[model samples]
Target: MTLAQRTPAEEAPAGASYPDLRWFPPGTHITVRGLKKAFDGNPVYVGFDIDLPKGKIVSVFGPNGCGKSTFINMVAGLLPIDAGQILFEGKTIAETRIGYVFQNYREALFPWLRAIDNIHYPLRLMGIGKAERERRIEELVAGFDLKFDLHRYPYQMSGGQQQTVSIMRSLVIEPEVLFLDEPFSALDYEMTLIMRDQLQKVLVARGVTTVLVSHDLEEAVYLADKVLMLTRRPSRIADYMDVDLPRPRDPSTLTDPRFIDLKARTLEVFQNAVRAS
Candidate 1:
């Protein structure tokens, strides 16, 4: 029988065990069901299920090798899944417009292209005309309150600047979903703080559904509307906690009682997940 004709009970083959088919909750932008992945016979995800909310930043965090990157990569269609389905607003990945910011900014950006052209590359690929691409770049430049010259090559810019260009390139497409994998882990403490605030501002203003894979617990909680923690390989959800702390979070928010408390709770869950591994 076709999927549309099958009831939830009929989703699995007769006499076989399977996860119940569940509908996406209201406001869910991404739906992952029965997701499975393996590497060299080692399972990374098995029957994983999750619903990420629309226009919200959800941070994925956990112990080392918990499939945080794997999860996002699968969702982004950068890596193929072994089984099951992932959809954006009920549409398949190929039908969705998505952007991804890799952790390595230096490699992510093209050294040969000026920063502006780098940002324009994706737009060009999408068949956007020069005038329209210029318009979008200007919008991003204004939104980012950019100070550095876009005429410079990636190798000439500072680490933070290069990362900013990478982000702009990803965003210039005006994607429906954005994935960031440890975008700031390479920066020094001060630069990391700056980028965090800048990124938070633009993301909130744009209201894009974002999935972030971060190793730093503090960064994860600080930037997220919800924190999705994962257990080790064959990964499952360890904890999916909401960050009720107000937005436009700043340096001071780091020390806010609520932020501190939530971060501690997330850390506790993370530690437990690690120990269980």
Candidate 2:
């Protein structure tokens, strides 16, 4: 269905309405209300409410051990929500095409497949032909700056290299929504910044709706358009702060007062969650 078919929330901005949600494509207009989850009777989250708009980058933040990863997994359909509904583009989770990049590079990439083959795996599953798959893979490898060791196995590549391949594999099929669970945590400080900048460009260019979970406060504020701060587990959103600064943002923009204000606000919410926990 087109964006025009969607019924807009009463508070949506002017010239922006449902059935015409072009501003937030790929991403779901998620209304997460009363969400709760438990494993073996241990509750991780409860009574959460969040509105994740389309095409926007949302950073899910909380103190360590908060249900940030669990929340992301539930949204990605890797884990089932014990209670509450996850709506994607006004549809159920089953209707969305999600790409998940796990926290660990070792787990996300395959040791058995070559880089190109791994990148092509999803496209092949989607029934894309050989020529198209090669074209897509070439584009991804170049865009992400994959090494010439394309035919080498994951074990042969460095940590950063494996991560680049893993990320490329996830993006090959152009998922409707992308979940990045600390995709840069494994990289060294310098590599992290480089990858962060590159990933931001790629996500914006592809118009992919992205939800990122990261412990790096600066990274969250830098990469996300909105920050969703969660209370410690059983996790719940304490505050949602929008980063009103301009887009195609440079890392240098992090030094600006507006960006600093947003970061400070986000940290305050995090501190509140910690104390409340």
Candidate 3:
């Protein structure tokens, strides 16, 4: 469907009371209220609510099968929300320009396309000219430090390399809102750290509104400005936390006392959610 033709669930009435977060950024905040979904008569989510501000990183944490992925997918217009409302940048979720990075890098990147070509594909889809596309691809290649010889195909690249390309592909679209569905879940220990650091820089530099769905506690602490901890399937928002330490955080921050304190609080909430379920 065309961008303008898309629509989210419905509009809020005039003067409806809702939380406001205009202090963060002037454009593109994601607000979800009473979101519910079911598949094959099996309920996955119910009454989930969150307000993500622009230019901020929001991490979503939940147990397995809690519908975190489903939540993001519905926001991306990949699936329909059975109930509730989702607003993006003061517009319906369907009308927003969003970029999605799937949990599996191999599934998201085209195996047949070269690194540069894969990055260029979205530009082509947008009808950008050859010159501009090539220029942007060159910038991305340099910025990501992509190898010259490995531009052949996705199969030739390492897991980490494929992930870098996947992120670049999503960012190249200049999406106002980006959804990363466990993009680093498959990487090894060292690669995960490297990519996590790199992703923080990239997202910060662009002021991208980001939502990351991850189970890694450290990752959620390192990359997120606010972490939304959710309950198990038939899920709901359990707690919304603000990472108040500082900016330009490093992996070392995970070992800090404050980080430990924050993690402990989030874990307590998670455990309580489990017991309640």
Clashes of each: 0, 8, 0
What candidate 1 gets wrong by more than 4 Å, as runs, is: 1-22
Per-residue alpha-carbon lDDT of model 1 for 1-277, expressed as tens digits? 2355324554555875445454667799998888999999999988998999999999999999889998999999999999988888778999999999999998999899998899989998999999988888888888997889999999999999999999989988989999999999999999999999999999999999999999999999999999999998879999999998998999999999999999999989998999996
Against the true structure, candidate 2 reaches a TM-score of 0.86
Candidate 3 per-residue lDDT, tens place, 1-277, comes to: 2222333324534565445423224444887767889899888876666678888999989777878788888888889989877888667866777788888998889998897788899999999999998888777566565444546798888899888888989988888999999989899989999899889888988899999999897788789999988888788888889988786888778888999999999889888988888
lDDT, candidate 1, equals 0.91
Error of 2 at 126 (Å): 1.9
Give the TM-score ranking, best first. 1, 3, 2
Q: Which residue pairs show collisions in model 3?
A: none
Q: Which window of ten consecutive residues has the lowest lDDT sum in model 3?
A: 1-10
Question: In candidate 2, which residue ranges exceed 4 Å CA deviation?
Answer: 1-28, 145-148
Give one digit per residue, the lDDT tens place, for model 2 in 148-235: 5888888888877777777788888888888999888878988888788878888887878889999899999999888888887787
Assess every candidate by TM-score: 0.93, 0.86, 0.87
